[model samples]
Target: MDVTTRIGVVMNGVTGRMGYRQHLLRSVLAIREQGGVPLSDGRRVLLEPVLVGRGATKLRELARRHDVEHWSTDLDTVLGDPRWQVYFDAQLTSVRHKAVVAAIEAGKHLYTEKPVAETARQVVELARLADAAGLRHGVVHDKLFLPGLLKLKRLVDAGFFGRVLSVRGEFGYWVFEGDGQSAQRPSWNYRKQDGGGVVVDMFCHWNYVLENLFGRVRAVTAKAVTHIPRRWDERGEPYEATADDAAYGIFELDGGIIAQVNSSWAVRVHRDELVEFQVDGTEGSAVAGLWGCRVQHRSMTPKPVWNPDVPTTERFRDQWAEVPDNAVFDNGFKAQWEQFIRSVAGDGEHPYDFYAGARGIRLAEAGLRSSAEGRRVELEEIAP
Candidate 1:
């Protein structure tokens, strides 16, 4: 029998939506259900997280729910303890940098949600700090771990799609307006001051997905709009929408593979989910949803005409066929968390290190600047 690696985790922001559902419940406790991650060295990774937050009662409740006896409101005290090897942050985007920097200064491995910082410079600094400290660091780029995206990556690597030409990403859903009679998300999500907005929140996903599956973006031109001028809050009080709800951007990848990403918090879709990606290559094309992937090829191109006046049945409507499922894994977030643990144990490479995460933040910063200036922003222009 092999000994288990004792990992003490400082889990900040465990009471939030993502913190509770994804990190605490699904990733940590759920991974425990599967006997945790088995390392190649015959050691199992055991997570011992100390839930940290300002509210003592909330922290206690969360710790009890997860069967973790360790809890703390003082981040300094937790960081001072050598037992805690990793400091994980799932707090609001704006506060991530300071907390992460403090952890790094304390010589602890670090993992946190995406957008390492609200700005590119902050991300660069964080990257520099991590590198200087020689600590293992990673950011949550969970989309790449999605079963659908992984399938797409495999197909792309296999040349199932000859020379890749273009990619299209569609992401959106109907966000409830905080009218007096409706449920609304936290107000911070909609206010720029609170690090809220669809562009900042989601563009990180698109940046990593594009960089991983397609290529690194060399440039970007974007347009942003605030579709709904006002929305209701949890208090049923209407607040003016100050952030952009929709963003359309064109990305020039390294190899000239052009891609477009459309992100919104205000759109209706009939598809299985609001997030989907379609890639076109020389030999074949593929579309992926949360559940599966569909592929189409030159050999399967539907016979059609270029006449718009013809009936709707005149184009390549049925050319695509679903790619069979081949993955045997848990949720994407959970998988990432498991991998992070392995990486921290020195068993594998840190999945999405600070540099990769900084790149995503840089891309988002570029897009926002481009949208505001109505011009294309070159990746090189933004320092990472």
Candidate 2:
């Protein structure tokens, strides 16, 4: 027989797409279905989720639909409860700060979605609060845990990309402008007042990906634009799209590596995946996306002559070899949840802590600043 310890987690903002699909359904419920997370001492830690949100009807429906035992509309009441030891936030960026502050004051361990707060300052403050309160805290860095990126990381660790030179990343897809067609994203995503923009949303992911795999970003030069100026809201009402739908950024890393990434919600993707990164090095180069990775070594690289009147004759994409998935990978959200649960259960601390979250926000702020001023911005150390 195995001993099981049930840990309660206050899950906020599960009504949203990512929150509902990834965090609630795919992660917590899936973890529960799998007989809980196993511990080293032959003990298992089960996650008991208490769904918390502003909408009572929606929360109740979701709770009942998923067979969740606890559901609450009152965050204050939920925070005061001793049963829930962990607080997980996937709320809107604008309102995240206050809710997280309240949760921290309640002495709950924190786990949150990216861009932890609207600004870098708020994230640092939260980090300090969690640190002072002696609470374990972590932020979502799901991209790094993807199988493709995991393989990329393995190659890096094995010195496959010797003397890394540069990295190029493309991420985006066409989002419908709710006029004749319905917008896939919420109307808030097009409004700057709502803390929405490609820079704010995607830069955080890029920052972590770059730093964790390559090096820390030292400086950034970026241009952000609202390609789709006019858009209709969810209610079929016309409104000015105040947020930038597209952003192009060039980052200078600590190791003199240059990384260029283009993020856009208005552009159509031509690649195999929605997001792809090509890392070029002296030894070899690799292109990795959410699910696939292909590599081309320096020795195997093909050379083509540039001619104005000649037709190109090369299977360029097919030249690269596909990387194999040697091991099974769990859902990224679930994996992170398990790790956070283990941390809260007295295991070692989670590496993607509040400080790491702050750094991601710092990069986002820097990118926005660079775009606004039309000048390259250098990253400065932020402290609480």
Candidate 3:
């Protein structure tokens, strides 16, 4: 029989969409279902999440639903408690810095959502603080854990594509223009002051994806556009859209791989999900979606001349085939949470730590600057 390691979780922003869905329901409660993570030394890692939020009623409801007894509206009280060694933050982008800095000062190992801060300087400062405190840290780069992305990684590792050439990412969805009666997303997402915008939100994912699958971005040139100027809120009131609705950026990776990422809030997605990546190499290529991957390759270097008159069948349109789902894990976000818990238990390393998170934020910051200046921006310029 293994003894269980008691872990007290200080979870902030429990009421937010990502916080509740990924952290509360999937990570903490789902781990309970597996009887906790069993260790080889006859010990188990038990997660006890102490929900922290502003609303007492919602916290109480969440606690009751999860059969968790601990809930608190006072963050100071929770942080002062020595029993809790890990502090998790999923607050809005604007509040992430303060919450994380406080957690670090309290000497708790930290895990939080992406875009560590709005600027590269803040991210670097946080990383420095975490290192000085000697606390373990991780950030949510959940896209890497997606089954499709994981499969792409496997292909890359196996050298299926002899020499990687380029990568493309497409992410977007139709955002409702706020009319008098339209149901709009939270207003903050459309306002620059609120840290709401697709560039900041989605580019962080692109950074991790490019870093993990391809390489680090050395420089970037981008163009951002605000396609819609007005939108209606859920309250039947109109608000001005002040943020960019679409962003197109080209990245030069470390090894000469040119990567392009397109992010938009106003584009209509014909696919079930609005994210996909395509990788091209000298010998082969692969296209990955949320559910699966398809591969195309030249078995022996077959050459073909450009022919506009050729039919779709002659262009190897059907050459691509679906790769089997090799993952037996839960959702990507849940997998990341489980890993974070395991790492906190001193069993292994957390893959996306604070440094990685900072890098993503730096890339995003550079993207914004490039769009604003209408020129190329070097990663070294924003390098912490």
Top-TM-score structure, candidate number: 2
- Put down candidate 2 lDDT per residue, 154-255, tens digits, no spaces: 999999989999999999999999988899899888899999999999999998899899988999999999999999997899999999999999999978
Candidate 3 local Cα displacement, residue 252, angstroms: 0.7
* lDDT score of residue 383 within candidate 1: 34
Q: Is candidate 1 or candidate 2 better by lDDT?
A: 2
lDDT of each: 0.84, 0.92, 0.83
Model 2, residue 62: C-alpha shift (Å): 0.9
Better of 2 and 3 by lDDT: 2
Q: Would you list the rank order by lDDT, best first?
A: 2, 1, 3
- The model with the greater TM-score, 2 or 3, is 2
For every candidate in turn, the CA RMSD to the true structure comes to 1.7, 1.3, 2.2
Model 3 regions more than 4 Å off: 40-42, 180-184, 271-273, 300-316, 381-384
In candidate 1, which residue ranges exceed 4 Å CA deviation? 180-184, 314-317, 381-384
lDDT, candidate 1, 1-384, per-residue tens: 657877888989989989989998889878777777889888898888889988999998887776888998999999999999999999988888889989999999989898778887787788788878888888898888777888898898899989899998899887878674464467778888888888888888888899888888899999888898898887778888898889999999978899998998788886656688889988999988776888998898876657877667643545678887776846988888888899888899874787788788888888899999999999864332
Score every model by TM-score.
0.96, 0.97, 0.94
- Best candidate according to lDDT: 2
Indicate the TM-score of model 1: 0.96
What is residue 52's positional error in candidate 3, in angstroms? 0.6
Report the error of model 2 at residue 192, Å. Answer: 0.5
Error of 3 at 301 (Å): 7.7
